[model samples]
Target: MKLALFLVLLTLSMSTRAVLDDCTCLVDCKCKKSLRPGQYYCASPDVDTDSQAIRNCNRDTGTVEVPCYAAPNVSCGGLPYNATQCIFTESRPCTFVNGKRYNYYLAVGLSLFLGMLGVDRFYLGYPAIGLMKLCTMGFFLIGHLLDFLLILLQVVGPADQTGYYAPFYGPLVSRVLVNGTDPFIESSSSCTL
Candidate 1:
């Protein structure tokens, strides 16, 4: 029984390869010799080398679906990105698609204006330290000076729904410096693969 099963599997494998070899592309897109019919594969116009073969391919009157590997760095908001171009900057700033960049002018103005009183820190959700700064005049003397330095460097901001840094100064600065870009657009219509 075991020998029969093994023979059958081997025959099936050989037959599958033969079918793949005979497969032809009906579309005019870039073609790769390694690609077999009923199997999926990626063809890049820019690159000369062929990528890994896809497991399967299926098409219908409405749409042609193939398990094409997603381009790298491409992401759909929080979803995993495939392949997309990304830019990096030194002062990482938060940016959404459609060219919506977060503003830091208000924080800078507030910090410079009331930083001595830790008002900026409070605005950044550090109420505990803000209170301390308010009471002791930013801890006066050495403490005050250090705290002032920290505020000058702009080390504060909003929290997300989870109460974590929704938009913090450090991350913002880093993103700006890196100048990263995500090609995977986030759209209501483009949900779910």
Candidate 2:
């Protein structure tokens, strides 16, 4: 029975791998063969080899790729695509602040638990505010609530004017406008005065 079950699992895994190997582009793009065997790119016909809008693919392995611009020092405004060219772009995620870093979850935890003692303020390097909170018991509890809200919303950050360390596993919010367009809108057909 164990051997039969193993064979069944093996068959399922091979079938899944086969399905993944048959991935294809959904857009009206053409395949441009690469020098590597079974590897190619899917891109618009109008785009040249120098263009950054190409999507790499492997026909043999069946891997879908995310298109990205490879230019150095180019900022994508936290989006997947370039703001100017509308082509996909990639950037490294940052968690540093002035050569140091503080964990986001740790800040939130400190604020939630020991905010009244001003430990959270001290951790964030705000010594003045920490002193005030320590003396007044978090400003009669009002300041503690306010600080908690500020920290939760990510409005208050490190003392160096840089951001806090990013969480390892959670949603990351980036307030970036792409192409000067409103992200709340679903369509761009509306006429403006």
Q: Pick the candidate with the highest lDDT.
A: 2
TM-score of each: 0.31, 0.44
TM-score of 1: 0.31
Question: Mind giving the per-residue lDDT tens digits that candidate 1 earns over 1-193?
Answer: 6576455544544443434333332332232223343223232211112211122211111111222221233322233422221111011112221112223455455566676687756766578887888888767745556655554454443422111122332323322222344233222222233
Checking candidate 2 for backbone clashes, the offending pairs are 21-62
RMSD of candidate 1 to true structure, Å: 18.4
Best by TM-score: 2
Q: State in Å the error of residue 112, model 2.
A: 1.2
- Model 1's alpha-carbon lDDT is 0.37
Q: What is the C-alpha lDDT of each candidate?
A: 0.37, 0.51
Worst 10 residues of 1 by lDDT: 84-93
